[model samples]
Each structure stands twice: as structure tokens, then as C-alpha cells.
Target: MALLQIISAMAMAIAAPLFLGQPLFTLPVAAQAQWSRVHEIPGFGLGTWRSNGDQAAHAVEYALSLGYDHIDAAHIYRNEDETGKGIADANVDRRYIWVTSKLWNTDHQPDRVEPAIRQSLSDLGLDYLDLYLMHWPVAFVPGDGTELDRETSIVDTWRAMEDLVRANLTRFIGISNFSRRNLNVILDICDICPYAHEFELHPYLQQNDFVNFHKEVGIKVIAYSPLGNTNPIYNGRHGNLPPLLEDPFWKKLADVKGASVAQTVLAWGMRRGTVVIPKSVHENHIYQNMFSLEINFNVLEMYNISQQDKRARMNNPSESWGVELFADLDDHTSLDGNKGQEL
Candidate 1:
């Protein structure tokens, strides 16, 4: 997989100039500025995936106090109520904070969509979400059993999500964990295309081509697990690969930049115009990550980081989900169609 990524990266490095030449190195200031104005999402935000109860609330409150205006939450995270309390406790003006949540797979059915968003609204104590997303491409029945819900087409679910925009349940709608093939499934036939697309992205799994596609279509890219391999949810199949933070190459770069490894990586994502949502319950880590926005990589630094791509995807459930989720990308996993719990 690493060899494949290296070859692919070399190919892209040679051919990239033919498409967008100048911005490839310099951060594309003009393009990024335009995206910022249009997207309105904070380039840096807090991710609340595993944090729950008081912990989740405290993290949200503290992050808000520390100048973070975006909070990523999901119904499946099972901490929306607590997360809302944290937001309320912070006393930050509601208009300033960007609260995002996702609809669970069970709610993919068109009829169940509105009810699900309403429930999330009730749980989060928010009248409307700044951004709402279809949690995943695959769907499941309301109850037990992991059978893929083939009856509910993604186009139907997406149309229902578009209605949420008209109904004002959420200001924007998007998708997560969707491959290019899955996105095309909606993009081919939809009244409103996704405003954003969130997925696993870091130095190791830098899907340059995939990310570029989103850019061409004007879909904002939200990078979850931006720190790479730090999320326990992903048990990598790579024999003994170190966590992204501990990589010697990244550490050396961090030392040269006088920033922590986490900041170094997060800054790389931001420099590329991708919004980074890094999850952390620790105050020090949260503070450091927010400060990543201040760090900038030079053209050489950016190129060096880009060369570190191993194409190692750490988040995948294709085997467990009974369907191929990221068939177009490398996940180091096979689709066995076995039943498994939602991540």
C-alpha cells in the first residue's frame, strides 16, 4: 500500500501542474479566502466523537471559551444532550457558534429524516444546526441486525435532507464517510448537493485526488481524525506502524517549526483549505490544536509533508458493514459483508 501511494504521489506530482499550477505550493490564498467567505465554517473546530456526559460538556465549554466557534457532534456519539449543556454553559452567543450534528443510519429513510433531525434538535437544545450531515452512506434497519437497508436509496435520503434546509432545521447539509462513488450516487440526481464532505484524512491517508474532486464541485472538505491513528476506533492493520504524532519525520518537522506534532499536522490540513476537526478532551491539547491555525508551512514544507503520504486509511467498516464503503480508496480491509456494530 505504501509503495502504491508513493507511485501515485509521484504521478500526481508530475501531472498536477497541468490542472492548477500556481496554487499547488503557496496555499492558494485567493481561493481559500473565497471558500472561507462562502463556507462560513471555522477552519479550526472541536470534534466530540467519544467524549460523553460531563466530559463532553466540559470540553465543549472550555473549547468555546478558548475561541473555538465550531463543535462537531452526532446522534451516534450519544452525547448531544451533554454537549448542548456545555454550549449553554459557555454563554457564548448562539449566533457565533457553529453546531454540527449527524443523522444516524437508521434515520436514512425519507419519512424518518425530519423526525431524526427534530430529535437531535431536542437533544442539543438548539433550534437549528449550523450544519447537519448524513452520517454514513450505508443504512441499517431501525432495530437490531446489520442488514444493509437497500430499500432506502441515498438519493431519497438526500432529498429529505435538502428539505431540512427549506424547513430551516439545519443551515447546511452534508455527507460523511462517503466515497467518491457514493457521492456521485447523490450528485448525479439531487435538487441540492452536499455542502460539505467529512472523512478520514491526515498525512498518512491524504486522498489528494478525492479531496480535489470536492474542491472542483465546491463541497467543503471536513477532515475528521485529522491527527491520524489517534482515534481508538481505528485498529490499523498495518503491522507496526507508529501513531502519526510519533513519526520521526513529523517530529523533526515540528522541531524545526517550533510547534507540537499535533499542531504541525493540523496546520498542514488547514494550509490545504480543509477544515480540521481534531478530537481531544484535554485542555492543553485543545489549546494547542486551536493554535495550529497560526502555523504555516512553506512550499517546501508542504511538499515534504505531502511526500509522507502512505495511503494508510485507519477508519473503515467495510468488512463489518456488509458492503464496500470506500471501494475507490485503500482501507487495508476487504468487504466481507459481516455484521458488526456501528462505529
Candidate 2:
């Protein structure tokens, strides 16, 4: 049955390879072109990080129905099966929607890379992924929880990822949660520079310098946790900082624009040239988030938000991973003052 589905999907692709819909996918130019004008992923997408259980599928399906052209998933999320079911349940055509998944630390070994993506494809019920990212710069033993594997070379793992593009399993490749130091290493030697980099970015925790660096290198930024402190995983990690939605400045801005706080921040992320993936299970929030594209921030508003950068990083697992993440950025040792014993 899966084989038949693959054949049918291939036949469909051959018949309609030129996708010129809302979220466009430009055909790769020969060799070097792959490195240039890489992908046209949508500005807004639905995130499936803690979007687990039946709600995960429902959120994805509803988001797509509401005109979300992109969906982000990862193997570590452990909800790809539900995410796939949601995509299949949606009425929209697959060609119009962009799907992204990630490779977990445990699968960073060169030989394990291909099978890792294959497993993600199987769960997502797709013949190919629009983008696949390395979940983190860290690597771990296959079954060991948070046990670092210091021997695996990220260059070799990236080589395997580049091959996925050639094999037509994924259209583009990127990295997530990598600091400036980690990114520079890849930039120095990668055959195909990363097309995008996913990390935490919000009004309160904006890393302006790092964001600029990505722009200088031509890498698209995908902002996860765009709403700030909304993800349950960040329950106590914020250290007394008020929820971003309740910030007086942002609230005033949202009121002025006649938009919700969520909408305002999401628009800010897009206006600054980054992709924003805000997750939600409620139908109302999903509907509101999609229309964030319509919220235009004025020059002053943008400037004011920029001035609010607190450099308060929320999602750092350096201590647990035993490597200093975001080593060169603000709040590098925020989480438990973990200086990365291994590092």
C-alpha cells in the first residue's frame, strides 16, 4: 500500500512539478543554484513541538484548513504520526503546503542520518519533505538519554543530509538551535550552506547580532516560540519575566493596531524577515494567527520592539547536553549556570 502511494505521489509530482501557488517552491538550478535562491518557505507556519496526542493532528488539520501553507515537525516531537494524519485529513493539496522536520541528536551519526529521515518520512506519510533540519549541534548515543557522543563529526552528518536533497527525499536542509560558533564551523566547510536556521526569537529575547549574522550569510531564520513564554516547556525557565503577551508595550502596540498580542508579535517576526511558527490547539487562536500576515507594523513600532530586546534566552539545554550552546550570545549561562562540563 505504501509503495502504491509512493508511485502515485511520484506520478503526481511529474505531472505538476512547477508549484506556483501561495507558498512557492522554485526549482533548483544546477549545482551552485542549489546554494542560491534555495527555498521560498512561507513566512508563517504551524509548530508541532508540544503539540502531542490527538490535539496535534487536529491543530495541524485546522491550521491548514485556515490557509497555513507551512507545518513544522521533528522526530523528537514524537508526534509525526499525528501530524501526518492531520495533513492527510486536510482538504488542501500537498503541493501547496510546505512541511519541515528535524533530525534528533541521537541520529547525527553519518550512517544513521538517512534512516532517521526515512523514519520521519514514514511517520509524516510523505514521499518527500520540503525541509529537514539538524535538531541541534549536539549528538548523543542512540538509546542513551542526553549522553553525548563526542566522536561523531557534524560535517559527515551534514554530508549525509546533502545527499538527501540529491536523493529527492528533502528539498532543502538547515540547522536549528546552533550558536554562532557552531554555525561558523558549518559555514566554513559545508558543500551547501544551510538554507535556514531555527531558533528562539521574540521581542523579549531578540538576539539582534545573531539574527544579523544569519542574514549576512543568506540563511532564512525560523522563529520558534515566537509568542514568548507560551510554550509549556518554558514554565519556570523564564525567571520572573512576565508573559510577553502581558507586556505593557506590546499590549499598547496591539491595541493600536487592533490586533491580538499573538498577532502583533508574529507580524513583527515576519516583518523582520524571519519565519514564525506559533503552535495552538484552539480553533480561534489558529484562525487569528493565520491573519497575522495582515498586521503591518509602523516604523516607530518596529523600532520600539527592537528596543525591548532583553536577551533572555529561554530554551537552552547546554548543561544536559554537556556542550555550551549559544556560547557567544547573551545569557549563555542562563540555565542553572551550566558552563558545559564537557566543553
- Scored by lDDT, the top model is 2
- Model 1 clashes, total count: 1
lDDT of 1 at 130: 79
True lDDT of residue 290, candidate 2: 66
- lDDT, residue 169, model 2: 82
Q: Which parts of model 1 have CA positions greater than 4 angstroms off?
A: 1-39, 336-343
Candidate 2 deviant stretches above 4 angstroms: 1-39, 334-343
Q: Which residue pairs collide, candidate 1?
A: 322-337
Full-model lDDT for every candidate: 0.81, 0.82
* TM-score on alpha carbons, each prediction: 0.85, 0.87
Q: Residue by residue across 50-169, what tens digits does model 1's lDDT show?
A: 997899999999988776778999999999999999998987555556789998988898999999999998998887787899999877888667767877877888999999988877
Best by TM-score: 2
Model 2: per-residue Cα lDDT over 1-343, one tens digit each = 2222343355446545444354355443233224322158888889998887899999999877666778999999999999999999985566567899999999998889999999999999887888999999888888858888888877778888998888878888999988887888889988877999999999878898889998998999999999988777787876678888888888899999898998889989999999999988888888778667778878887888899988888888876666777878888763444446323
Error of 2 at 189 (Å): 0.9
* TM-score of candidate 1 to 2 decimals: 0.85
